[model samples]
Target: MRGPLVLACLTLLGAEASAQEVVKIGHVAPLSGPQASFGKDNENGARMAVEDLNAQGVTIGGKKIKLELVAEDDAADPKQGTAAAQKLCDAKVNGVVGHLNSGTTIPAAKIYNKCGVPQVTPSATNPELTQLGYKTVFRLLANDNALGAGLANHAAKQLKLKRIAIIDDRTAYGTGIAEVFKKTALANGVEIVDQQATNDKATDFMSILTAIKGKKPDGIFFGGMGPQAGPMLRQMQQLGLGKVYLFGGDGVCTAELPKLAANVKTIENVVCAVGGAALDKRAQGVEWKKRYDAKYPGQFQIYSAYAYDATMVLVDAMKRAKSTNPAVYAAKLFDTDYEGVSAHVQFEPNGELKNPAMTLYVYRGGVRVSTN
Candidate 1:
C-alpha cells in the first residue's frame, strides 16, 4: 500500500509540472491625457494579442494554457507609473507589457525589477532605462540611439540640411532623443543651430519658435510628443518658417495629431520616427486592427502592437522555461524569439530589441505615411 501511494503522489506531481496553468500578464500605460489616445491604442493592441493567444489553444508543457491580461492605467505620469507597477507586482503577475512614457517607464523599471516581475515596454525609447543593468527590464521599441541616427541621416543625407535647430520637452524620452539627434546630427554635419526646452503640458511655443527662428535653420528636430509638435508646427508657419522640416520621435507619431495640424499645413513636411512595424501595415496586425476598431473605434496608438507582443513573449517564455516563477523564466527571457504580429521578437544583453528597426514617417494629408 505504501509503495502504491508513493507512486501515485509522484505521478500527481509530474502531472502538475506538465499541466497548463492560468498565467496573468500585466499592462501599465497612460489611459488618459493629451496622450490618452496613444495609450488607448496601445492597450487595444495588447488586448488583441492576449485574445489571439487565448483563441489559439496553445499547448504549454504538454497541457493547454491561456493568457490573461492584468491592465492598469499609468496616465503617462511617473508617480502613477510607479503606483501602477507596485499594483501589478502586488498582484504577483507573471509579466508586464508597458508604462509608455520614458519618464514613467524609467521610474517603474526599478519597481518591477525589485518585485521580480519582468516588464517589456513597446514605446519607451530612453537609453537610461536600460543603462541601469536590471535583468528584469526589457524594451522592444527602438531606443534613442537608433531613432536619433535615423533622423540625423535623413536631415543630412536626404534633406541636405547643413544647419538644424533642436528642441526637447526635457523628460527622459525627450532629452535623451534630442541629445542623441544633436550628437548624430553633428557627426553627420547637420549643425545644431539652436537648442531649446519645453514642458510636456506647454501649449505655447511662441517664444521658443521666435528664438529658434532667429537661427534660420533648414530643419527643426523636436524631441517630444504631438501636443508640442502640432502647436510648434503651427507657430513655425505663423513665423513664416514653412521651409524647415519638423522632425520628432514616436512621441509625435499618432493618428490624433492631425486634429492639431488643421492650422499648420506645413506639418505635411513633418517627419516622425518610431521603432515598431507599422501597425496599419502588418499582416496579422490588419486583422487585429480591424477587431480593435470594432471593439474601440478610431483609436490607433503606437504602442498597442508592442504591448500585445510583450504579453505573448512572457507566456512563451514561461512555456519554454516550464515555470511561472519569473526568476527561472527571466533567465530564459533573454533568448525570447516569439514570431509576433509586430515582428520577430528577441532581446539583447541590455534587454533592448535584438535588431533595432526604425521607420521614418511623414504626415501626408494628416495621415501617417511611411516613406521608408
Candidate 2:
C-alpha cells in the first residue's frame, strides 16, 4: 500500500513537468567586452525576472509556463548584435530584452522587426532608434534628446556656465547626444569654445584634453560611455582642468565611473544625466534596490532596474494577451501603460517612451548622486 501511494505521487509530479510550457525570452548585451559589467548586470536582471516569474508559476493560455531566458553576448559590436538577434529569431523566442548600446540596438532592431519578434531595449538612449517606424521595437528609457537638453538647461540656467566645449566618440549614441547638447547649449546663449572627436576605444585623451584646455571653457561636455569618460576625467585632472565642469549624457553615467577616474579630484566636477527618475525619488526604489542587492550582491548599475522593468513589461504584456506569441502581444506593447519601477512605462506612436523622464546627477564623495 505504501509503495503504491509513492508511485502515484511520482506520476503526478512527472505529469506536471510534462505539462509546463517553456517560453523563451531572448536577452542580448555586451557580456564579454569593455562594457561587460553593464551587460552582466542587465543579463542578471532579466534572469532574475525569469526566475521570479517561473517561481510564481505563470499560467498563460491555460498552460503553466516556464520562462526561459536565452541570453546572447553582443560584445558591444554592431555585427555581433545583429548576429545575436538573428540567432534569437531562428530560435523563435517570444520576446527580447536588450542590446545595451544604441549602436548595437539600432542594427539589431531591424532584425527583430524583420523576424517579427518584439524587441525592448533597456539602456539604448539614441532617439534615432524609434524613428525607424518599427512597430515591434520599444524602449524603456528616455532618449538622448531629452537627456542632452536637460543637462544643457541645468548648465545654462542653474550652473550658469556660458563657455563650454563639446567632445564626442562619433558613435551613434555619442555623436547624437553631443549634437543635441550642442544645439541646446547654443540656444541657451552658451558659447561653444571648442569641439573635438574621439573614438570609444581610445584610452589616451591627452591630445584632445590639451586642445580643449587651451580654449579655457568653463565646462566640457563629453558624449561617450563610462569606459571612455573615466579616463577622460583622470586626464582632465592631470591637465589641471579639474575645476572645469564636466557634463555628459547617460552613456557616461555609471557606478564604475568614479573607479575609472581613479579617484581623481575632477570626479566631483562631473555631471551626467540618465533617462529615468533617480532611485531615491522612485516610490519603489528603496525596496526594489534592496531586493536587487540581495540577489546580485553589489552589482547595481544604472540600467539594471530598467532592464528588470523591461522584462516585467514584456511578461506583463504576455499575461495581458493571455498568450506568449509575439505577434499577439506586440500590439499590447504599443498600448503599454504599465507602472515600472523607474517610471510609468508607456509607448508613444513612434515607439518612444511616453512622457520620458530624465534625471541629472553629480558626484559627491565618489558616489553619483541625483540632483533632481
Candidate 3:
C-alpha cells in the first residue's frame, strides 16, 4: 500500500510540472530614492495581477501558463530606465508594465520597441510618449494636455484666479505638464507672474517660493511628484503662501501627499488632477480598490490600479491572440477593449487611452479626496 501511494504522488508531481509553462512580464519603476513608495506600490499591483492570473489557471495556445513579474528599479532616471529596459529585453520578457515617470518611460520605450517587446506604461502621462510612434508602446492614462488643461479650466472658471506662478522640477513629466498648464492658463486670460524651476530631489524651495511670493500670484501650479510637492507645501506654509491655491497634475495626487506635507493647512489648499475616475465613484473601481487594499494594506497609490490593468491588458492580448510571443500578440493590444478596474482599456492609433477620464482632488481634513 505504501509503495502504491508513493508512485501516485510521483505521478501527480510529474503531471503538475509538465502542465505549467512560465511567461515573464517586466515591471519598472523608482523602487529606490524618494519615489520608492510609489515603486513598491506599482510592483505590488503587478505581483497581484500575476498571482490572480495564475490562480485562474490562465491558458495560452492550449497550454497552462504561469505568469511571473520581473520588477526593476529605474530610480525615475532616464538612463537607468533605459538600462533596465535593455535588461528586460535581454531577459526576453513577453511584456512590460511600467517605468512610472515620463522621463523614464519615453527613453525606455525605444529600448523595448527595438527589442519587439510590448511595453505598457501605467502612469507616465506626457503627450509626447504616445507621439513617439512606437507600435509596442501603450499608455493607460490621460496625457498632460488633459490633466493640465483640466486644472487650468477649473482654476479659471471655478477659482477665478487672475495671477498664477508656475514651478517645475524640469524633468520630462514636470516641464511637459507645466508647459501645457502655462499655455492653457495664458489662453484663459490668467497672468503668468513668475516661472521657476527645481530638481526632483531638491528639498529647499525657499528661493523659488520667495520669488513667487514677491509676484503676489493668486495661485501656484507645481509640476512634479508628491515627494517634491510635499516639501514645497511645507515651505509654502512657512513663506505665508498657505492661503494661495496650490495646483498640480497626477504627479502630486497621491494618498501620501498629505502625510508628506504634514501641513494640513497647505495640504487643504492643494488641488491636483489625476488622469482617471475616482475609485469611490466607479463601481468597478470601488470593488477593485477594496481587494487591492485588502492585499496591500495602507499602501494604495494612484498608479497601482493602472499597473494592474496594464498587466491584465497584456495578458488579455495574449489570450486573444492565443500566443505569448510579444511580436505575435502585440498587435492584438491595439484592438483591446477590456473592462479593467480603471476603465475600458482601449487605445487610439497613437497608443493613448481612448476617452481617458480625468479627476480633480483636494485634501479634505487631511485626507486626499476626489473633487471630481
Which of 2 and 3 is ahead in lDDT? Answer: 3
Off by over 4 Å in 1: 1-20, 62-66, 279-282
Q: Write model 1 residue lDDT over 1-372, tens digit each, in one string.
A: 569889999999988766757778888777778777778777787787778888887676666776788889888889989999999999988888888899999999999889999888888999898999899989887899899889888889988889899889978989999999998999987788999999888889999989988899889998999877888878888899988888888899776677776647787878889896776567887876777678877777677778778878888888898777888888888988888767788889989888867888987777778886
Which residue pairs of candidate 2 clash?
Answer: none
Scored by lDDT, the top model is: 3
Estimated TM-score per prediction? Answer: 0.90, 0.97, 0.97
Residue-wise C-alpha lDDT for candidate 2, range 1-372, written one tens digit per residue: 569889999999999999999999999999887888889999988888888888888988788999999999999989999999999999999999988999999999999999899998999989999999899989998999899999999999999998999999988999999999999999999999999999878889999999999999999999998999999999999999978999999888987789999989999999999999887787787778888899899777788888888898998888889998999888988778788778899888888889888888999998989887
Per-residue lDDT tens digits for candidate 3, residues 192-218, read 999999999998999999989999999
Score candidate 3 by TM-score against the native.
0.97
Per-prediction RMSD in angstroms? 5.3, 1.3, 1.3
**Clashing pairs in model 3, backbone N/Cα/C closer than 3 A:** none
Give the C-alpha lDDT of model 1. Answer: 0.84
Clashing pairs in 1: 30-75, 42-304
The reply for model 3, stretches above 4 Å from the true place, is: 1-9
Better of 1 and 2 by TM-score: 2
Q: What's model 1's TM-score?
A: 0.90
